[model samples]
Target: MATGDTMQLVHQALRENSLFARLDAADLERVVQMASVRELAEGEALFHEGDLVEHTHVVADGLLRVYQVGPKGSRQLVLHMAGPPESIGEIAVLSERQHYPVTAEAALPSRVVRVPREGILQLMEERPRFTRALLRSVAERQFELLLLLRRVAFFEVQSRLAQYLLEQHATLGPGFPLPTNPELAALLGTVPEIVSRTLSRFYKQGWIRLEDRRVWLENEVTLIAVAKG
Candidate 1:
């Protein structure tokens, strides 16, 4: 259960979320009554892949790293990073899943509101609007995952890397300090050596420049060509 200003803040954030956006204040309050705020220390795992499906959670505070294990079981293929007002594990619960499909870990000290599968089921029965909202949210997530799959399955690693760089450049601008090689590899679904080799090639071709652990986007036109391939 949440209390005081923290509870108020959580309510405000949830109000903005599409899942709860259509709900009236009274209905929203009822939803909160069925949820509990859980705090996770940095590196704590909210759930692991294959764990039995139990509860779904939404971020009340801080960041979550959603990922899957690679074939060797040592490497991680990062799926996405979700933050405040975002829901994780909701899909599994909605789908009546038996086990989790991925792992959710705390990227920072975080607070999340855990909502029981049973409780959501009850809410859906009572609130048609809430059910519609959840369906729409799930549909959007499915399409996003489809696009990611298309990129991973059809595009070459170099093309994906180029696209990732272009996206980060557009979002963060030039001279942005990049994640370590291994982290980049996890995100790009490749090995560190491959990521290093690709970046080196980019540098040699004058498409990008590296300095002091930061990247400079030197030629957008050429990088765009690589990304489109």
Candidate 2:
């Protein structure tokens, strides 16, 4: 597409995103002018942990996976799967942090709006509501991180897997497409083999049934009991 058309698309996306909804026409125009579009292929890295924070990104299309690689490169933990209209790296931008805390990779072919940090800071100064909204977004993400940490620290692999399955079922129904074992392992902070074994146990316990990529819940009450363990 033409550059003008691309900018128009980006502008419309920004307007639709709740984080940018409060901006007036002129402020929104400033943001569009300062923004650039980034297209990422599947499994491509957008930014790595410890990279200098420069642009605050918003996913305009497709999914981005936020993760952290362990010290010895032995493990990767999936922190978040961000989709359209979701802001990435906002915490670093808001906190004036120099580096990103997590790596962002494209889970699918993705398009992101890259807004310069200066432009975001300008918006915060001129738009009080925008600042509050950004802070709230950060706080919400922090709460989610806390909950995830609690689960990882206290829950067993089986319990965490059960909870994840139930949550996915609730959101996407019983026939939800389950993520691959490796992906689930990253999300649950375990290895793929353990994830596979847990799923097998679930199947044997009559808590869930898997066919191809789809998962069906056989007994939600029992799954919930397992999850609460």
Best model number under lDDT: 2
Return the top candidate by TM-score: 2
Candidate 1, which ten residues in sequence have the lowest lDDT sum? Answer: 1-10
| lDDT against true structure, model 1 | 0.85
User: Candidate 2's residue-wise lDDT over 1-229, tens digit each?
Assistant: 7898889878977987778878889888889988999899999999999999999898999999999999899899888889889889889897756999999999889999999998888888988999998888888889989978989999999999989999999898879988789888999989999999999988998888999979999999998998998
Model 1 spans with C-alpha error above 4 angstroms: 171-177, 209-216
Q: Can you write out model 1's per-residue Cα lDDT over 102-168, one digit (the tens) per residue?
A: 9999988998877788877887899898899888888887886777788889889899899999998
lDDT of all predictions, in order shown?
0.85, 0.89
State the TM-score for model 2: 0.95
TM-score against truth, every candidate = 0.86, 0.95
Off by over 4 Å in 2: none
